[model samples]
Target: MLLPRSYINISFFQPPAFLLIGIPGLEAAHGWISIPFSSMYAVALTGNCLILLAITRTPSLHQPMYYFLSMLALTDVSLTLSTLPTTLAVLWFDHQSIGFNTCLVQMFFLHTFSVVESSVLLAMSFDRFLAISNPLRYAAILTNNVIIRIGIVIVTRATVSIFPVPFLLKRLNFCPNKTLLSHSFCFHPDVMRRACDDITINILYGLYVVASTASIDSLLIALSYALILRTVLGLASPRERVRALNTCVSHILAVLVFYIPAIGMSIIHRFGKHLSPIVHVLVAYVYLLVPPVLNPIIYSVKSKPIREAMLKVLRKKGQGS
Candidate 1:
Protein backbone atom coordinates (compact mmCIF):
# COMPACT_ATOMS: atom_id res chain seq x y z
CA MET A 1 0.00 0.00 0.00
CA LEU A 2 1.22 3.42 -0.96
CA LEU A 3 1.45 5.58 2.11
CA PRO A 4 1.03 9.33 2.16
CA ARG A 5 4.10 11.22 0.97
CA SER A 6 5.72 14.22 2.56
CA TYR A 7 8.01 16.45 0.53
CA ILE A 8 10.78 17.40 2.91
CA ASN A 9 14.40 18.45 2.28
CA ILE A 10 13.76 18.28 -1.51
CA SER A 11 13.09 14.52 -1.18
CA PHE A 12 9.93 12.46 -1.51
CA PHE A 13 9.48 10.57 1.76
CA GLN A 14 6.77 8.05 2.59
CA PRO A 15 6.11 9.50 5.95
CA PRO A 16 2.95 7.50 6.57
CA ALA A 17 4.53 4.06 6.90
CA PHE A 18 7.19 3.37 9.50
CA LEU A 19 9.19 0.16 9.78
CA LEU A 20 9.32 -1.53 13.16
CA ILE A 21 12.39 -3.34 14.48
CA GLY A 22 12.42 -6.69 16.23
CA ILE A 23 14.91 -7.13 19.05
CA PRO A 24 18.15 -5.57 17.89
CA GLY A 25 21.17 -7.89 17.47
CA LEU A 26 18.76 -10.76 17.91
CA GLU A 27 16.87 -10.64 14.67
CA ALA A 28 18.22 -14.04 13.75
CA ALA A 29 16.54 -15.43 16.85
CA HIS A 30 13.20 -13.63 16.51
CA GLY A 31 11.51 -16.89 15.56
CA TRP A 32 13.01 -18.63 18.54
CA ILE A 33 12.25 -15.64 20.78
CA SER A 34 8.61 -15.61 19.67
CA ILE A 35 8.02 -18.92 21.39
CA PRO A 36 8.40 -17.32 24.81
CA PHE A 37 6.76 -14.05 23.80
CA SER A 38 3.74 -15.91 22.46
CA SER A 39 3.60 -17.99 25.61
CA MET A 40 3.67 -14.91 27.84
CA TYR A 41 0.97 -13.20 25.81
CA ALA A 42 -1.13 -16.34 26.01
CA VAL A 43 -0.74 -16.52 29.76
CA ALA A 44 -1.57 -12.84 30.10
CA LEU A 45 -4.68 -13.18 27.95
CA THR A 46 -5.94 -16.28 29.73
CA GLY A 47 -5.09 -15.16 33.24
CA ASN A 48 -6.72 -11.75 32.93
CA CYS A 49 -9.80 -13.23 31.29
CA LEU A 50 -10.20 -15.60 34.19
CA ILE A 51 -9.90 -12.75 36.64
CA LEU A 52 -12.64 -10.86 34.83
CA LEU A 53 -14.81 -13.93 34.60
CA ALA A 54 -14.40 -14.64 38.26
CA ILE A 55 -15.23 -11.08 39.25
CA THR A 56 -18.28 -10.90 37.03
CA ARG A 57 -19.73 -14.26 37.93
CA THR A 58 -19.15 -14.11 41.68
CA PRO A 59 -21.63 -11.97 43.65
CA SER A 60 -19.44 -11.51 46.72
CA LEU A 61 -16.75 -9.67 44.75
CA HIS A 62 -19.03 -6.74 44.01
CA GLN A 63 -17.17 -4.39 46.31
CA PRO A 64 -14.89 -1.41 45.73
CA MET A 65 -11.58 -3.29 45.90
CA TYR A 66 -12.69 -5.91 43.44
CA TYR A 67 -14.16 -3.24 41.22
CA PHE A 68 -10.79 -1.56 40.95
CA LEU A 69 -9.25 -4.97 40.35
CA SER A 70 -11.68 -5.63 37.51
CA MET A 71 -10.65 -2.30 36.03
CA LEU A 72 -7.02 -3.33 36.24
CA ALA A 73 -7.79 -6.61 34.55
CA LEU A 74 -9.56 -4.81 31.69
CA THR A 75 -6.68 -2.39 31.25
CA ASP A 76 -4.18 -5.24 31.16
CA VAL A 77 -6.21 -7.04 28.54
CA SER A 78 -6.49 -3.88 26.43
CA LEU A 79 -2.76 -3.22 26.67
CA THR A 80 -2.00 -6.76 25.62
CA LEU A 81 -4.37 -6.52 22.67
CA SER A 82 -2.98 -3.17 21.56
CA THR A 83 0.60 -4.43 21.23
CA LEU A 84 0.12 -8.08 20.39
CA PRO A 85 -0.58 -7.86 16.68
CA THR A 86 2.36 -5.68 15.69
CA THR A 87 4.67 -7.56 18.03
CA LEU A 88 3.74 -10.95 16.62
CA ALA A 89 3.87 -9.64 13.08
CA VAL A 90 7.43 -8.51 13.68
CA LEU A 91 8.55 -11.60 15.53
CA TRP A 92 6.83 -14.40 13.67
CA PHE A 93 6.51 -13.13 10.11
CA ASP A 94 9.30 -10.52 10.08
CA HIS A 95 6.70 -7.96 9.09
CA GLN A 96 7.52 -4.54 10.50
CA SER A 97 5.92 -1.89 8.33
CA ILE A 98 3.10 0.05 10.03
CA GLY A 99 1.04 2.81 8.50
CA PHE A 100 1.10 6.29 9.98
CA ASN A 101 -2.51 6.56 11.14
CA THR A 102 -2.52 2.98 12.34
CA CYS A 103 0.65 3.61 14.31
CA LEU A 104 -0.95 6.67 15.85
CA VAL A 105 -4.02 4.66 16.84
CA GLN A 106 -1.81 2.02 18.41
CA MET A 107 0.21 4.64 20.28
CA PHE A 108 -2.91 6.30 21.62
CA PHE A 109 -4.38 3.09 23.06
CA LEU A 110 -1.00 1.85 24.26
CA HIS A 111 -0.30 5.00 26.23
CA THR A 112 -3.90 5.64 27.31
CA PHE A 113 -4.20 2.17 28.83
CA SER A 114 -0.78 2.38 30.45
CA VAL A 115 -1.75 5.60 32.18
CA VAL A 116 -5.12 4.08 33.06
CA GLU A 117 -3.29 1.15 34.64
CA SER A 118 -1.24 3.52 36.76
CA SER A 119 -4.30 5.41 37.82
CA VAL A 120 -6.10 2.19 38.70
CA LEU A 121 -3.20 1.06 40.87
CA LEU A 122 -3.30 4.38 42.66
CA ALA A 123 -7.02 3.94 43.18
CA MET A 124 -6.44 0.42 44.50
CA SER A 125 -3.93 1.77 46.99
CA PHE A 126 -6.52 4.25 48.13
CA ASP A 127 -9.04 1.44 48.50
CA ARG A 128 -6.56 -0.47 50.65
CA PHE A 129 -5.96 2.57 52.80
CA LEU A 130 -9.68 3.10 53.31
CA ALA A 131 -10.26 -0.53 54.17
CA ILE A 132 -7.48 -0.53 56.73
CA SER A 133 -7.90 2.97 58.15
CA ASN A 134 -11.67 3.23 58.26
CA PRO A 135 -13.20 -0.17 57.93
CA LEU A 136 -16.61 1.01 59.09
CA ARG A 137 -17.00 3.73 56.46
CA TYR A 138 -15.28 1.98 53.56
CA ALA A 139 -18.51 1.08 51.83
CA ALA A 140 -20.00 4.51 52.41
CA ILE A 141 -16.92 6.24 51.01
CA LEU A 142 -16.49 4.06 47.93
CA THR A 143 -20.01 3.07 47.10
CA ASN A 144 -20.94 1.28 43.87
CA ASN A 145 -21.95 4.62 42.35
CA VAL A 146 -18.67 6.15 43.51
CA ILE A 147 -16.67 3.33 41.93
CA ILE A 148 -18.48 3.83 38.64
CA ARG A 149 -17.66 7.54 38.70
CA ILE A 150 -14.05 6.74 39.45
CA GLY A 151 -13.92 4.43 36.49
CA ILE A 152 -15.27 7.16 34.26
CA VAL A 153 -12.69 9.61 35.58
CA ILE A 154 -9.90 7.12 34.99
CA VAL A 155 -10.82 6.61 31.34
CA THR A 156 -11.53 10.28 30.73
CA ARG A 157 -8.31 11.48 32.30
CA ALA A 158 -6.16 9.06 30.38
CA THR A 159 -7.92 9.75 27.09
CA VAL A 160 -7.85 13.53 27.47
CA SER A 161 -4.25 13.54 28.63
CA ILE A 162 -2.94 11.35 25.81
CA PHE A 163 -5.20 12.57 23.01
CA PRO A 164 -2.85 15.33 21.91
CA VAL A 165 0.17 13.11 21.42
CA PRO A 166 -0.74 11.80 18.01
CA PHE A 167 -1.84 15.19 16.70
CA LEU A 168 1.43 16.67 17.88
CA LEU A 169 3.35 13.96 16.07
CA LYS A 170 1.16 14.35 13.01
CA ARG A 171 2.29 17.94 12.60
CA LEU A 172 5.95 16.92 12.40
CA ASN A 173 7.59 15.81 9.18
CA PHE A 174 9.22 12.40 9.32
CA CYS A 175 12.19 11.75 7.07
CA PRO A 176 12.08 8.58 4.95
CA ASN A 177 15.21 6.85 6.21
CA LYS A 178 14.48 7.88 9.78
CA THR A 179 11.19 5.99 9.87
CA LEU A 180 12.66 2.85 11.45
CA LEU A 181 11.49 2.42 15.07
CA SER A 182 13.39 0.58 17.80
CA HIS A 183 10.67 -1.76 18.93
CA SER A 184 8.01 -3.91 17.30
CA PHE A 185 5.36 -1.37 18.38
CA CYS A 186 4.97 2.34 17.73
CA PHE A 187 6.01 4.11 20.92
CA HIS A 188 5.82 7.88 21.37
CA PRO A 189 9.55 8.35 21.87
CA ASP A 190 10.42 5.99 19.06
CA VAL A 191 8.05 7.68 16.64
CA MET A 192 8.93 11.21 17.77
CA ARG A 193 12.62 10.55 17.25
CA ARG A 194 11.99 9.86 13.57
CA ALA A 195 10.62 13.32 12.88
CA CYS A 196 12.84 15.80 11.13
CA ASP A 197 10.91 18.78 12.43
CA ASP A 198 11.09 20.39 15.85
CA ILE A 199 9.66 18.21 18.64
CA THR A 200 10.20 20.30 21.73
CA ILE A 201 6.45 20.53 22.26
CA ASN A 202 5.96 16.80 21.86
CA ILE A 203 8.76 16.10 24.32
CA LEU A 204 7.43 18.58 26.84
CA TYR A 205 3.87 17.33 26.52
CA GLY A 206 5.00 13.74 26.96
CA LEU A 207 6.84 14.73 30.12
CA TYR A 208 3.77 16.55 31.38
CA VAL A 209 1.55 13.50 30.95
CA VAL A 210 4.11 11.24 32.59
CA ALA A 211 4.48 13.59 35.53
CA SER A 212 0.75 14.06 35.92
CA THR A 213 -0.10 10.37 35.79
CA ALA A 214 2.59 7.89 36.71
CA SER A 215 4.88 10.08 38.83
CA ILE A 216 2.07 11.63 40.82
CA ASP A 217 0.33 8.28 41.16
CA SER A 218 3.51 6.70 42.50
CA LEU A 219 3.83 9.28 45.25
CA LEU A 220 0.19 8.96 46.22
CA ILE A 221 0.43 5.19 46.31
CA ALA A 222 3.39 5.48 48.67
CA LEU A 223 1.49 7.89 50.88
CA SER A 224 -1.49 5.56 51.00
CA TYR A 225 0.75 2.63 52.01
CA ALA A 226 2.39 4.75 54.73
CA LEU A 227 -1.00 5.60 56.16
CA ILE A 228 -2.06 1.98 55.95
CA LEU A 229 1.06 0.98 57.85
CA ARG A 230 0.37 3.54 60.56
CA THR A 231 -3.22 2.48 60.82
CA VAL A 232 -2.34 -1.21 60.96
CA LEU A 233 0.30 -0.63 63.65
CA GLY A 234 -2.26 1.12 65.84
CA LEU A 235 -4.41 -2.00 66.01
CA ALA A 236 -4.12 -3.79 69.39
CA SER A 237 -4.23 -7.35 68.15
CA PRO A 238 -1.02 -8.70 66.61
CA ARG A 239 -3.02 -11.12 64.51
CA GLU A 240 -5.21 -8.30 63.26
CA ARG A 241 -2.09 -6.30 62.33
CA VAL A 242 -0.67 -9.25 60.43
CA ARG A 243 -3.92 -9.80 58.61
CA ALA A 244 -4.18 -6.13 57.65
CA LEU A 245 -0.62 -6.10 56.38
CA ASN A 246 -1.25 -9.34 54.55
CA THR A 247 -4.17 -7.81 52.64
CA CYS A 248 -1.72 -5.40 50.99
CA VAL A 249 0.77 -8.05 49.96
CA SER A 250 -0.88 -8.76 46.62
CA HIS A 251 -1.06 -5.08 45.80
CA ILE A 252 2.56 -4.56 46.71
CA LEU A 253 3.57 -7.42 44.49
CA ALA A 254 1.48 -6.03 41.64
CA VAL A 255 3.04 -2.59 42.03
CA LEU A 256 6.55 -4.01 42.00
CA VAL A 257 5.82 -6.20 39.01
CA PHE A 258 4.58 -3.17 37.11
CA TYR A 259 6.73 -0.17 38.09
CA ILE A 260 10.11 -1.90 38.26
CA PRO A 261 10.24 -2.79 34.60
CA ALA A 262 8.53 0.44 33.63
CA ILE A 263 11.16 2.44 35.52
CA GLY A 264 13.88 0.20 34.11
CA MET A 265 12.70 0.87 30.59
CA SER A 266 12.64 4.60 31.26
CA ILE A 267 16.17 4.45 32.68
CA ILE A 268 17.41 2.40 29.73
CA HIS A 269 15.94 4.88 27.29
CA ARG A 270 17.25 7.97 29.06
CA PHE A 271 20.50 6.80 30.69
CA GLY A 272 21.42 3.40 29.27
CA LYS A 273 22.58 4.58 25.88
CA HIS A 274 25.84 2.83 26.58
CA LEU A 275 24.00 -0.46 27.03
CA SER A 276 23.42 -2.86 24.19
CA PRO A 277 20.42 -2.30 21.93
CA ILE A 278 19.22 -5.75 22.89
CA VAL A 279 19.07 -4.61 26.51
CA HIS A 280 16.72 -1.76 25.65
CA VAL A 281 14.50 -3.99 23.51
CA LEU A 282 14.39 -6.72 26.12
CA VAL A 283 13.48 -4.28 28.87
CA ALA A 284 10.77 -2.75 26.72
CA TYR A 285 9.26 -6.17 26.14
CA VAL A 286 9.33 -6.96 29.83
CA TYR A 287 7.80 -3.62 30.75
CA LEU A 288 4.88 -4.18 28.44
CA LEU A 289 4.35 -7.93 28.93
CA VAL A 290 5.25 -8.86 32.49
CA PRO A 291 2.56 -7.25 34.67
CA PRO A 292 -0.43 -8.77 32.91
CA VAL A 293 1.17 -12.18 32.95
CA LEU A 294 1.82 -11.99 36.71
CA ASN A 295 -1.03 -9.91 38.18
CA PRO A 296 -3.64 -12.67 38.03
CA ILE A 297 -1.19 -15.11 39.53
CA ILE A 298 -0.39 -12.72 42.35
CA TYR A 299 -4.05 -12.19 43.20
CA SER A 300 -4.96 -15.85 42.77
CA VAL A 301 -2.28 -17.01 45.16
CA LYS A 302 -2.79 -14.21 47.66
CA SER A 303 -6.55 -13.58 47.71
CA LYS A 304 -8.51 -16.63 48.72
CA PRO A 305 -11.79 -15.22 47.46
CA ILE A 306 -10.62 -14.62 43.89
CA ARG A 307 -8.92 -18.01 43.80
CA GLU A 308 -12.07 -19.72 44.99
CA ALA A 309 -14.19 -17.86 42.48
CA MET A 310 -11.86 -18.81 39.65
CA LEU A 311 -11.87 -22.43 40.75
CA LYS A 312 -15.64 -22.43 40.91
CA VAL A 313 -15.72 -21.08 37.34
CA LEU A 314 -13.41 -23.85 36.20
CA ARG A 315 -15.40 -26.57 37.94
CA LYS A 316 -18.64 -25.39 36.37
CA LYS A 317 -17.02 -25.50 32.93
CA GLY A 318 -15.58 -28.90 33.72
CA GLN A 319 -18.95 -30.26 34.76
CA GLY A 320 -20.61 -28.78 31.70
CA SER A 321 -18.02 -30.40 29.45
Candidate 2:
Protein backbone atom coordinates (compact mmCIF):
# COMPACT_ATOMS: atom_id res chain seq x y z
CA MET A 1 0.00 0.00 0.00
CA LEU A 2 2.79 2.35 0.92
CA LEU A 3 5.55 3.16 -1.54
CA PRO A 4 8.08 0.34 -1.50
CA ARG A 5 10.46 1.03 1.36
CA SER A 6 14.21 0.56 1.12
CA TYR A 7 15.31 -2.60 2.96
CA ILE A 8 18.62 -4.06 4.08
CA ASN A 9 19.57 -7.72 3.80
CA ILE A 10 21.14 -7.59 7.28
CA SER A 11 18.32 -9.82 8.46
CA PHE A 12 16.52 -12.68 6.74
CA PHE A 13 13.78 -11.10 4.68
CA GLN A 14 11.13 -12.29 2.28
CA PRO A 15 11.31 -11.24 -1.34
CA PRO A 16 11.66 -7.50 -1.82
CA ALA A 17 8.76 -5.39 -3.04
CA PHE A 18 9.14 -2.72 -5.74
CA LEU A 19 7.53 0.69 -6.11
CA LEU A 20 5.14 1.32 -8.98
CA ILE A 21 5.04 5.01 -9.73
CA GLY A 22 2.23 5.74 -12.16
CA ILE A 23 3.98 8.53 -14.00
CA PRO A 24 7.41 9.17 -12.60
CA GLY A 25 7.85 12.85 -13.44
CA LEU A 26 4.19 13.79 -13.02
CA GLU A 27 3.43 12.46 -9.58
CA ALA A 28 1.33 15.51 -8.74
CA ALA A 29 -0.78 15.01 -11.88
CA HIS A 30 -1.32 11.24 -11.57
CA GLY A 31 -4.74 11.88 -10.04
CA TRP A 32 -5.92 14.16 -12.84
CA ILE A 33 -4.32 12.00 -15.53
CA SER A 34 -6.01 8.86 -14.26
CA ILE A 35 -9.36 10.37 -15.24
CA PRO A 36 -8.72 10.15 -18.99
CA PHE A 37 -6.87 6.86 -18.66
CA SER A 38 -9.77 5.43 -16.70
CA SER A 39 -12.24 6.67 -19.32
CA MET A 40 -10.29 4.96 -22.11
CA TYR A 41 -10.19 1.78 -20.08
CA ALA A 42 -13.94 2.00 -19.49
CA VAL A 43 -14.61 2.36 -23.20
CA ALA A 44 -12.22 -0.48 -23.97
CA LEU A 45 -13.94 -2.82 -21.53
CA THR A 46 -17.46 -1.94 -22.71
CA GLY A 47 -16.59 -2.20 -26.39
CA ASN A 48 -14.67 -5.47 -26.24
CA CYS A 49 -17.22 -7.17 -23.98
CA LEU A 50 -20.08 -6.07 -26.24
CA ILE A 51 -18.20 -7.43 -29.26
CA LEU A 52 -17.82 -10.80 -27.58
CA LEU A 53 -21.49 -10.77 -26.62
CA ALA A 54 -22.69 -9.74 -30.06
CA ILE A 55 -20.59 -12.35 -31.78
CA THR A 56 -21.85 -15.06 -29.46
CA ARG A 57 -25.51 -14.08 -29.72
CA THR A 58 -25.52 -13.61 -33.48
CA PRO A 59 -25.64 -16.87 -35.41
CA SER A 60 -24.72 -15.06 -38.61
CA LEU A 61 -21.29 -14.25 -37.13
CA HIS A 62 -20.34 -17.92 -36.81
CA GLN A 63 -17.93 -17.59 -39.70
CA PRO A 64 -14.15 -17.43 -39.44
CA MET A 65 -13.78 -13.65 -39.56
CA TYR A 66 -16.16 -13.09 -36.70
CA TYR A 67 -14.61 -15.97 -34.82
CA PHE A 68 -11.20 -14.33 -35.09
CA LEU A 69 -12.74 -11.02 -34.14
CA SER A 70 -14.15 -12.62 -31.02
CA MET A 71 -10.73 -13.99 -30.16
CA LEU A 72 -9.24 -10.52 -30.61
CA ALA A 73 -11.95 -9.09 -28.37
CA LEU A 74 -11.16 -11.64 -25.70
CA THR A 75 -7.43 -10.93 -26.01
CA ASP A 76 -8.06 -7.19 -25.83
CA VAL A 77 -9.93 -7.72 -22.59
CA SER A 78 -7.08 -9.86 -21.32
CA LEU A 79 -4.53 -7.21 -22.33
CA THR A 80 -6.49 -4.42 -20.64
CA LEU A 81 -7.02 -6.46 -17.49
CA SER A 82 -3.40 -7.59 -17.28
CA THR A 83 -2.10 -4.20 -16.15
CA LEU A 84 -5.08 -1.88 -15.60
CA PRO A 85 -5.75 -2.64 -11.94
CA THR A 86 -2.21 -2.22 -10.70
CA THR A 87 -1.62 0.76 -12.94
CA LEU A 88 -4.76 2.51 -11.70
CA ALA A 89 -4.03 1.56 -8.15
CA VAL A 90 -0.65 3.20 -8.39
CA LEU A 91 -2.11 6.32 -9.97
CA TRP A 92 -5.38 6.67 -8.05
CA PHE A 93 -4.85 5.00 -4.70
CA ASP A 94 -1.07 5.40 -4.30
CA HIS A 95 -0.77 1.65 -3.87
CA GLN A 96 2.66 1.47 -5.43
CA SER A 97 4.27 -1.26 -3.38
CA ILE A 98 4.15 -4.82 -4.75
CA GLY A 99 5.93 -7.96 -3.59
CA PHE A 100 8.39 -9.93 -5.70
CA ASN A 101 5.98 -12.79 -6.39
CA THR A 102 3.19 -10.37 -7.21
CA CYS A 103 5.43 -8.44 -9.57
CA LEU A 104 6.49 -11.65 -11.30
CA VAL A 105 2.86 -12.71 -11.61
CA GLN A 106 1.89 -9.35 -13.06
CA MET A 107 4.84 -9.26 -15.43
CA PHE A 108 4.14 -12.80 -16.62
CA PHE A 109 0.50 -12.04 -17.31
CA LEU A 110 1.26 -8.77 -19.07
CA HIS A 111 3.92 -10.21 -21.32
CA THR A 112 2.09 -13.49 -21.90
CA PHE A 113 -1.08 -11.71 -22.97
CA SER A 114 0.94 -9.49 -25.25
CA VAL A 115 2.54 -12.51 -26.87
CA VAL A 116 -0.87 -14.15 -27.12
CA GLU A 117 -2.37 -11.09 -28.78
CA SER A 118 0.44 -10.96 -31.32
CA SER A 119 -0.07 -14.63 -32.07
CA VAL A 120 -3.80 -14.09 -32.46
CA LEU A 121 -3.18 -11.25 -34.85
CA LEU A 122 -0.81 -13.43 -36.83
CA ALA A 123 -3.43 -16.17 -36.96
CA MET A 124 -6.06 -13.66 -38.10
CA SER A 125 -3.75 -12.51 -40.86
CA PHE A 126 -3.36 -16.09 -42.02
CA ASP A 127 -7.15 -16.41 -42.01
CA ARG A 128 -7.42 -13.37 -44.26
CA PHE A 129 -4.66 -14.68 -46.48
CA LEU A 130 -6.49 -17.96 -46.95
CA ALA A 131 -9.84 -16.25 -47.57
CA ILE A 132 -8.37 -13.90 -50.14
CA SER A 133 -5.87 -16.12 -51.91
CA ASN A 134 -7.73 -19.37 -51.82
CA PRO A 135 -11.41 -18.48 -51.67
CA LEU A 136 -12.65 -21.89 -52.79
CA ARG A 137 -10.72 -23.64 -50.01
CA TYR A 138 -11.23 -20.97 -47.35
CA ALA A 139 -14.03 -22.78 -45.57
CA ALA A 140 -12.21 -26.08 -45.82
CA ILE A 141 -9.00 -24.57 -44.44
CA LEU A 142 -10.55 -22.56 -41.59
CA THR A 143 -13.23 -24.85 -40.28
CA ASN A 144 -14.33 -24.72 -36.64
CA ASN A 145 -12.00 -27.53 -35.72
CA VAL A 146 -9.07 -25.78 -37.38
CA ILE A 147 -9.81 -22.46 -35.69
CA ILE A 148 -10.07 -24.25 -32.35
CA ARG A 149 -6.72 -25.86 -32.97
CA ILE A 150 -5.18 -22.51 -33.90
CA GLY A 151 -6.49 -21.02 -30.68
CA ILE A 152 -4.96 -23.86 -28.70
CA VAL A 153 -1.61 -23.44 -30.46
CA ILE A 154 -1.68 -19.70 -29.77
CA VAL A 155 -2.28 -20.14 -26.04
CA THR A 156 0.29 -22.88 -25.81
CA ARG A 157 2.92 -20.85 -27.68
CA ALA A 158 2.58 -17.81 -25.46
CA THR A 159 2.35 -19.75 -22.21
CA VAL A 160 5.34 -21.94 -22.99
CA SER A 161 7.47 -19.08 -24.30
CA ILE A 162 6.85 -16.84 -21.28
CA PHE A 163 6.99 -19.57 -18.63
CA PRO A 164 10.72 -19.28 -18.18
CA VAL A 165 11.19 -15.50 -17.92
CA PRO A 166 10.13 -14.96 -14.33
CA PHE A 167 12.00 -18.06 -13.25
CA LEU A 168 15.05 -16.78 -15.09
CA LEU A 169 14.67 -13.46 -13.29
CA LYS A 170 14.03 -15.15 -9.95
CA ARG A 171 17.36 -16.96 -10.15
CA LEU A 172 19.22 -13.66 -10.14
CA ASN A 173 19.93 -11.68 -6.98
CA PHE A 174 18.89 -8.06 -6.65
CA CYS A 175 21.91 -6.98 -4.65
CA PRO A 176 20.65 -3.45 -4.52
CA ASN A 177 18.30 -2.77 -1.61
CA LYS A 178 15.64 -1.14 -3.82
CA THR A 179 14.97 -1.14 -7.53
CA LEU A 180 12.45 1.08 -9.26
CA LEU A 181 10.32 0.14 -12.24
CA SER A 182 10.16 2.53 -15.19
CA HIS A 183 6.39 2.49 -15.54
CA SER A 184 3.72 1.63 -13.00
CA PHE A 185 4.45 -2.00 -13.79
CA CYS A 186 7.24 -4.52 -13.81
CA PHE A 187 8.77 -4.68 -17.25
CA HIS A 188 10.99 -7.63 -18.15
CA PRO A 189 13.89 -5.40 -19.13
CA ASP A 190 13.61 -3.27 -16.00
CA VAL A 191 13.39 -6.38 -13.85
CA MET A 192 16.39 -8.00 -15.54
CA ARG A 193 18.45 -4.86 -15.21
CA ARG A 194 17.71 -4.63 -11.48
CA ALA A 195 19.91 -7.61 -10.80
CA CYS A 196 23.61 -7.15 -10.12
CA ASP A 197 24.47 -10.47 -11.67
CA ASP A 198 25.47 -11.07 -15.28
CA ILE A 199 22.27 -10.54 -17.23
CA THR A 200 23.62 -11.40 -20.68
CA ILE A 201 21.53 -14.53 -20.64
CA ASN A 202 18.39 -12.60 -19.67
CA ILE A 203 18.86 -10.03 -22.37
CA LEU A 204 19.74 -12.62 -24.97
CA TYR A 205 16.88 -14.91 -24.07
CA GLY A 206 14.40 -12.00 -24.17
CA LEU A 207 15.65 -10.97 -27.59
CA TYR A 208 15.39 -14.54 -28.85
CA VAL A 209 11.81 -14.81 -27.67
CA VAL A 210 10.85 -11.51 -29.30
CA ALA A 211 12.62 -12.44 -32.52
CA SER A 212 10.96 -15.82 -32.68
CA THR A 213 7.46 -14.63 -31.78
CA ALA A 214 6.60 -10.95 -32.31
CA SER A 215 9.16 -10.15 -35.00
CA ILE A 216 8.43 -13.30 -36.96
CA ASP A 217 4.70 -12.77 -36.64
CA SER A 218 4.96 -9.19 -37.88
CA LEU A 219 7.05 -10.22 -40.86
CA LEU A 220 4.66 -13.01 -41.80
CA ILE A 221 1.68 -10.68 -41.45
CA ALA A 222 3.37 -8.27 -43.81
CA LEU A 223 3.94 -11.09 -46.28
CA SER A 224 0.34 -12.12 -45.92
CA TYR A 225 -0.81 -8.62 -46.77
CA ALA A 226 1.62 -8.38 -49.67
CA LEU A 227 0.18 -11.57 -51.11
CA ILE A 228 -3.32 -10.33 -50.35
CA LEU A 229 -2.61 -7.09 -52.18
CA ARG A 230 -1.24 -8.94 -55.21
CA THR A 231 -4.37 -11.06 -55.29
CA VAL A 232 -6.66 -8.06 -54.86
CA LEU A 233 -4.88 -6.12 -57.61
CA GLY A 234 -5.40 -8.94 -60.06
CA LEU A 235 -9.21 -8.77 -59.73
CA ALA A 236 -10.91 -7.25 -62.80
CA SER A 237 -13.62 -5.16 -61.15
CA PRO A 238 -12.81 -1.92 -59.31
CA ARG A 239 -15.62 -2.65 -56.87
CA GLU A 240 -14.08 -6.02 -56.13
CA ARG A 241 -10.73 -4.39 -55.43
CA VAL A 242 -12.36 -1.78 -53.19
CA ARG A 243 -14.38 -4.40 -51.37
CA ALA A 244 -11.38 -6.64 -50.79
CA LEU A 245 -9.17 -3.79 -49.65
CA ASN A 246 -12.01 -2.54 -47.46
CA THR A 247 -12.08 -5.82 -45.58
CA CYS A 248 -8.38 -5.40 -44.88
CA VAL A 249 -8.72 -1.82 -43.65
CA SER A 250 -9.53 -2.75 -40.07
CA HIS A 251 -6.73 -5.31 -39.89
CA ILE A 252 -4.13 -2.97 -41.36
CA LEU A 253 -5.12 -0.23 -38.93
CA ALA A 254 -5.07 -2.70 -36.07
CA VAL A 255 -1.61 -3.83 -37.04
CA LEU A 256 -0.36 -0.28 -37.42
CA VAL A 257 -1.95 0.86 -34.17
CA PHE A 258 -0.26 -2.01 -32.40
CA TYR A 259 3.14 -2.12 -34.09
CA ILE A 260 3.87 1.57 -34.62
CA PRO A 261 3.71 2.50 -30.95
CA ALA A 262 5.46 -0.74 -30.08
CA ILE A 263 8.25 0.01 -32.54
CA GLY A 264 8.40 3.63 -31.39
CA MET A 265 8.75 2.58 -27.78
CA SER A 266 11.50 0.18 -28.66
CA ILE A 267 13.27 2.83 -30.69
CA ILE A 268 12.96 5.36 -27.91
CA HIS A 269 14.24 2.87 -25.41
CA ARG A 270 17.20 2.07 -27.58
CA PHE A 271 18.19 5.49 -29.01
CA GLY A 272 16.07 8.41 -27.84
CA LYS A 273 18.51 9.90 -25.39
CA HIS A 274 16.80 13.30 -25.41
CA LEU A 275 13.46 11.77 -24.47
CA SER A 276 12.49 11.82 -20.82
CA PRO A 277 11.16 9.05 -18.58
CA ILE A 278 7.62 10.36 -19.12
CA VAL A 279 8.00 9.71 -22.84
CA HIS A 280 9.04 6.11 -22.29
CA VAL A 281 6.32 5.45 -19.75
CA LEU A 282 3.57 7.03 -21.82
CA VAL A 283 4.75 5.32 -24.99
CA ALA A 284 4.94 1.98 -23.27
CA TYR A 285 1.50 2.42 -21.76
CA VAL A 286 0.06 3.54 -25.07
CA TYR A 287 1.55 0.54 -26.87
CA LEU A 288 -0.64 -1.68 -24.72
CA LEU A 289 -3.57 0.68 -24.11
CA VAL A 290 -4.37 1.97 -27.59
CA PRO A 291 -4.93 -1.44 -29.23
CA PRO A 292 -7.69 -2.54 -26.88
CA VAL A 293 -9.32 0.87 -26.96
CA LEU A 294 -9.37 0.87 -30.77
CA ASN A 295 -9.89 -2.75 -31.83
CA PRO A 296 -13.62 -3.02 -31.09
CA ILE A 297 -14.40 0.35 -32.63
CA ILE A 298 -12.44 -0.57 -35.73
CA TYR A 299 -14.22 -3.93 -36.08
CA SER A 300 -17.66 -2.44 -35.54
CA VAL A 301 -17.03 0.25 -38.09
CA LYS A 302 -15.31 -1.88 -40.72
CA SER A 303 -17.18 -5.17 -40.45
CA LYS A 304 -20.81 -4.95 -41.61
CA PRO A 305 -22.09 -7.92 -39.68
CA ILE A 306 -20.72 -6.60 -36.40
CA ARG A 307 -22.09 -3.15 -37.13
CA GLU A 308 -25.54 -4.48 -37.95
CA ALA A 309 -25.54 -6.73 -34.89
CA MET A 310 -24.56 -3.75 -32.72
CA LEU A 311 -27.36 -1.64 -34.22
CA LYS A 312 -29.79 -4.49 -33.79
CA VAL A 313 -28.92 -4.77 -30.13
CA LEU A 314 -29.27 -1.01 -29.71
CA ARG A 315 -32.64 -1.01 -31.44
CA LYS A 316 -33.93 -3.87 -29.30
CA LYS A 317 -32.87 -2.04 -26.14
CA GLY A 318 -34.45 1.16 -27.43
CA GLN A 319 -37.75 -0.57 -28.12
CA GLY A 320 -37.66 -2.13 -24.65
CA SER A 321 -37.06 1.27 -23.14
lDDT tens string, model 1, 1-321?
Answer: 433343444543437588999988889999999999999999999999999999999999988999999999999999999999999999999998999999999999999999999999999999999999999999999998899999999999999999999999888877766878888998998889888788899989988998999999999999999999999989999999999999999999999999999888888887898998889788988989999999999999999999999999999989999
C-alpha positional error of residue 41 in candidate 1 after TM-score superposition, expressed in Å: 0.5
The global Cα lDDT (0 to 1) of model 2 is: 0.86
TM-score, per-candidate, Cα-based? 0.96, 0.93
For residue 73, what is the lDDT in candidate 1?
A: 95
The number of clashing residue pairs in each candidate reads: 0, 0
Model 2 earns a TM-score of 0.93
Per-model CA lDDT versus the true structure: 0.92, 0.86
Identify the leading candidate in terms of lDDT: 1
